[model samples]
Target: MKNLQKILKYALNYKKYALLNIISNILSVIFELVAMLLFIPFLNLLFNEKTVIVSSLPQFSFSKDYFEAYFNFTMNQYIADNDKLAALYFVCVLVGAMFLLKNLFRYLALFFIAVMRTGIVKDLRKDIYNKILILPLSYYSEEKKGDILSRITTDVQEIEFSILNSLEMLFREPISVILSLAVMIAINPHLTLFSLILLPITGLVIGRLGKSLKRSSSRVQQQMGVLLSTVEETLTGLRIIKAFNAEESSNKHFDQQNSSYASLTLKMTRKRDLASPISEFLGAMAMVGLAYYGGSLVLDGNSDFNGGEFIGYIIIFAKLIAPVKAFSSAYAIVQKGAASADRVDAILSAKNPILEKENPEILNTINENIHYNNVSFSYNKSDIVLNNIDLKIEKGKTIALVGESGGGKSTLADLLPRFYDVSSGAIEIDGINIKNLSLHGLRSLIGVVTQESILFNDSVFNNISFGTNNASREEVIEAAKIANAHEFIIQLENGYDTNIGDRGGKLSGGQRQRLSIARAVLKNPPILILDEATSALDTESEKLVQDALTKLMKNRTSIVIAHRLSTIQNADEIIVLQKGEIAERGTHSQLLSQEGIYKRLSDLQTFSN
Candidate 1:
């Protein structure tokens, strides 16, 4: 219920439409009640075979008897002046007008509700997406990609179907039921009281089943996420599965997850489907009991309870059943929707650790140097990745970081961009703590080309100009020339405008790497971080990418992480990291003279070559 309340809070954003909808529903209920109650006068006219006419109007008051007396006096005057057939014409016209206005208001209510429902859904999707963009990268490490995708796609859709579809019933049905029940009680309080006794029993049965359905629905949604995760993994690892000849194993794994999801859905559907029929059955039992009791009063020669009014009371009570049943069904669906709401709220309410200060300085340029002052970091408190490391790289100097995998080379570079903040110490830029600067302004001064060469399925021009907005074609081509990607790009079907397929799959490895370099070149920041940029390339591609890296590094403060020691021999200084500590720091000759870890690593690579 709290989850549903949280989901509905978004509706407040469009209060105008919600207010209009409520007003329209109230008017519609009133007109519908008036239309149904008019049948009582028609019954009285046919059965009594007599007419009582009032000569003058009574003084008006706000009692039910006063309104009834005034209405009866008006009807009596018209029937006395004309024949019963004329009065019949008047009644028919009045009933038709009532129904017409009732339906008009009902449509208007639906019109306003439509705007509110879709607008809330749109706002929900936008909020979820915006939250996803700002959540720190560490959040993705613990959550499966497919589960997150399911929350945004299928979980949201379930909310729209199960909860939003019930929005109208939640609003309108209570008014309909209350108004009809009020009229029933006015006709005979004894019968209405007897009917009320049976309703709570029906509600109890439905409420119990609704709770069970919610639990099952939660399981079904979780299984759906697992099923989607299996599918995503299969798609991403299709090549590996085929190469290993493990298609049979993959199919069996997917089948098990699919079967579990189907079984849970079946149970949830059975529970949800039982709500309507059982409620209808219980309502019928109550209605039968009321008929027996009410009929006894009329047949016992009770003058106060006439046959016409008794039949009218029964008619209004019958109308009340429809809305009661609708509300019960909606209750069941809302329980199911609450499960989905919980899933979406998990993301919307997730805490983001990467917070910017209220009044942070903007970093415009790097004048001095970047200093890592006793910096230490850990993904977890017990497992440190970088330990009390202190280093500095002056402006216009190149410093290289060489370490074994998992020794925190990439983690060290990532901290500078605030992908994850340092666990313990501070990184300062030009003697100012990086945390004291705006995130955008700080990251804007640094350019990175990573090993993955992350590219989108867009035109080469758009991909290259992705973050660097308003880049002219001439500037893009110039950057491409610097990265040595212009020759191959022009040979493509549409040159710079050519659409690279998913993740640049249509291009060769060298082309993708070079395009990523071209993007960095376009940004042309004063500081650059190259994380094993040439580690995965073949000899020819490495040579091409390495040459581009050399040109891009000229006169810029550069931090290079490399596995190949030959590439960084020309670096001004090389820092060798071992077990998250600086083991050696010097030029190529100076490090070799130490004959320590850097010397051993360089000798081993030389032997391997």
Candidate 2:
């Protein structure tokens, strides 16, 4: 219910629509009630040809008797002035007009609600996407991508179907039931009280069924996430699966999850489907009891309940059954929706580890050297990835990090932009702690090109100008030329406007890397971090990418993480890392002459080449 309330909070954002819906629904219910009340006078006309007419106008009051008296007086006057048929015609026209107004207001209510319903869903999706963007990278290391995808797509759809779709029933039905029940109490208090007794009993039964439904629905939603995760994994690893000829095994695994999900959905839907019929049966029984009691009163002559009024009361009470049953079904549906709300709330309420200071100072440019003061980091408590380390990198210096795989080179470079905060010490730029600076201001000064060139399915121009705002066509082309991507880009059919397929699959590895470099060049940050930018390319692509990287790194404070030793031979300084600690630090020539760890690594790579 807490999660359900959180979802309803989004409705507060569009109060005009909600208010309009409420007003329209209230009017619709009023007209419907008046339409039903007109049937009483029609019943009198049918049963009594010489019906007794009230001679004078009745005093106005709020009780049912006064309105009934006034209505009778008006009908009597009309019948006397004309004939009974003319009076009946007037009543029929009035009833039709009331029903017409009822439906009009109902349509208006639906019109207003449609805007609110779709608006709430749009805002919810926007918030989830924004939250995904701001969450620290470490959050994804433990969570599955498909499960998060399920929350944004499938879980939100469940909320729309089960909760938002019920908005009409939730708002309209209750008002109908309340207004009808009030009239019932006015028609006969004793009978209305008897009807009320049956409701709580029906509610108790429905409540029990609903409790298990939420639990079952939650399991179904979770299984959906697992099934989606399996599908996502299979799509991502299709090439590997085909290479290894593991299609049979993969299919069997997917089949098992699919079967489990189907079973859970079947059971949950069965429970949810039970609510409507049970409410209907219970309401029918309550109706039978009310008729028997009310009929006894008219027959025994011990009460003033007449045949015509009794029949009208029965008609209104019967109308009440439909909405009551609808209410019970809506309750069951809301229970199911609550399960999905719980899943969405988990993400919406997730705590972000990265915190910015309220009045953080701006970091527009680097004036002096960057410093890593006694830095230590660990993904967890026991497995430290980096030990206490201190280093300073002067502005405009190309400092290269060389090491074997899993030696914390990438982790060290990642810490500079605060992808993950240090576990112990702090990193500072221009003598100011990075934590003391605004994230946007701090990151705006740095550009990163990683081993995997992250490119989207977009035009060559848009991809290059992704993070850069208001970049013109000439600026984008100039940036591509600097990264050596302009030659191939112009050869394509649409030049800069050509669409690069998913992850830039339409382009070669070298082409993708060059585009990544072009994007960095366009941003033209004062600081650059190149993480193995050419490690995955062939010799020809490597030479092209390395040349562009050299141009992009010119006069910028660059931290280069590399595995190919030859590429960093001309670095101003090279830091060799081993076992999460700095093993050696010197110029490439100086380290090779030391006959130490750097000397052995350089010789090993030299031999391999």
Candidate 3:
């Protein structure tokens, strides 16, 4: 119940509908109780029992005169005629009518409750998805994609089905039990008192069982996350697993996780499953005892105990069992839902370490220099990836970064687009700190092409025009041509409309890179960051990509990170980084002549003189 309270805002949005459901449920319970109570009159006719007649209805300020009049009138008419069969038939018909009306309103109440429940679930899912999209890149580094995916799909669904559904039952079933009990007490107070004794014992047992279910459910949900993440990883890297011939190894890992998940699930299910049978057994015991005690009193001819009234009391008592069973089952579901809610709340309440400042400045375009002033960064607390890095690039010049792996080449490239912020110092554009700029405005100023060419399972044109919405056919083709991808795109059976299968697996590595370059070209931002964009290409593909990159780099402030020395030899300035700091900086010829880190790297690449 407390777990549900966390998301009350979403639920409260449709409070009017929820109120209607409650009203309908109350009406349903009233009608249902009326249907059960109708049995007393019918039993009296069948058994020829003494009429427990009251001359006037018990006086209460709120009691309506019409209700008392109707009751007296019916009783008098039955007594005067003494037609037992006709009275039984009339009571049976009235009972049937009340039952029918009860079922109708019950259906309507459940339908409206479902609407409110599913609507909140839908809104919650949409909010989570939007948060995923807007969250900083750093958030993903420590989180698993499959875990997040499970939260959105699996955990949320559990909350809807188990949590909210339980909440509905919690409301409706208790009202039913209370209404039925009221009628039972009205018929026979002594019998009602006998039945009430078991409630405390039942509550204690249920409480003891529920105490462990929430913790067990939480463990089960976590194991499920691990299992799902493992499966996701296996599927995404299936080709690698096959290529390495490690299917047996992968299966062992998957089986271990699967077994753990199964064990936890079995434990949770056992706890959840225990509630119904245990509750039923307790209810049965209470009913058997009540029947014994009441039967003894009736056999002794106690003035308050009558055969027909006792039968009606038993009938209403039987009705109480169903609601009790429902509540016990709902309690288990609520525990499971609480466990799920905790997991979801952990995510929803996570503090994003990186957030845009208030009253952020907006940059429509980058028309001046981009500066990295003593920028230092670290992914973890242990070691710095970049340190004391000072560099500047004019608006329309090309700057290239060259370094060995772990020398912060890619990290430096990432900082230009603010994919990550500098740890120690600031990055600024046009003398304004990048942190002060709105995230959308800062990112809109730059385009990136990374080593891995990420594309969705979509058409070529759609992939290229992804960033720039509503791009025309002519504009797409022009960008493709500039990327050296137009020729191959046309050669495909569907040309620009060709579907690039998952991650562009249908295309060759070079072709995928070309498409990625085309996507960046389509956006045509003022600044470009190409991180080893052509490193994985063959000589022939490299020539084409290098030509495409030359065209794209023109009149744009481009920052290129390269492993292959020949690719960036013609840059305006080249910087060699070593151990998180600038080791050397100069033009290509000057660095080559100095025979330092840059010259050593160039020589190691076996570049032509």
Highest-lDDT candidate: 2
Q: Candidate 1: worst 10 consecutive residues by lDDT? A: 47-56
Question: Where's the lowest-lDDT run of ten residues in candidate 3?
Answer: 60-69
Q: Which is the winner by lDDT between candidate 1 and candidate 2?
A: 2
Candidate 1 per-residue lDDT over residues 99-126, each given as its tens digit: 9999999999999999989988899999
Task: State the local distance difference test value for candidate 3.
Answer: 0.84
Worst 10 residues of 2 by lDDT: 44-53
Per-model TM against the reference? 0.96, 0.98, 0.94
Candidate 3 clashing pairs, residues 3+ apart or interchain:
none
Model 2 per-residue lDDT tens digits across residues 1-609: 999999999988888988888899889988988888877877866876336579999998999989888888998899889997898889889989999999999999999989989999999999999999999999999888889999999999999999999977888888888899989888889888888987777788888888899999899989898988899999889999999999999999999999999999999999998998899999899889989988998889778777777898989989988888888888899899989999999999999988999999997899999999999999999999999978899999999998878889999999988889999998999899999999999899999999999999899999999999999999999999999999999998899999999889899999999999999999999999999999999999999999999999999999999888888888999998888999999998899899998999988988998
lDDT of each: 0.90, 0.91, 0.84
lDDT of 2: 0.91
Q: Where does model 2 exceed 4 Å of error?
A: 48-52
Q: 1-609 in candidate 3: lDDT tens per residue?
A: 555578657888788778889889999999987777666655765777766555554545533334434555676577668776677777789889998999899998988898898889988888888778767788888888878887888889888878788878877988888878777766677778888997666767877787688889889888878878898899899999999999999999999988998899899899989988888888888889889988887778846667777887887787888888778878777877788887787677777766799999999887789999999999887978998999999899898999889899988988866777789888999999998999888889899998989899999999999989899999999999999999999999899999989999899988998899898999999999999999888899989998999999999999999989899989999989999899998899999999999988888779554
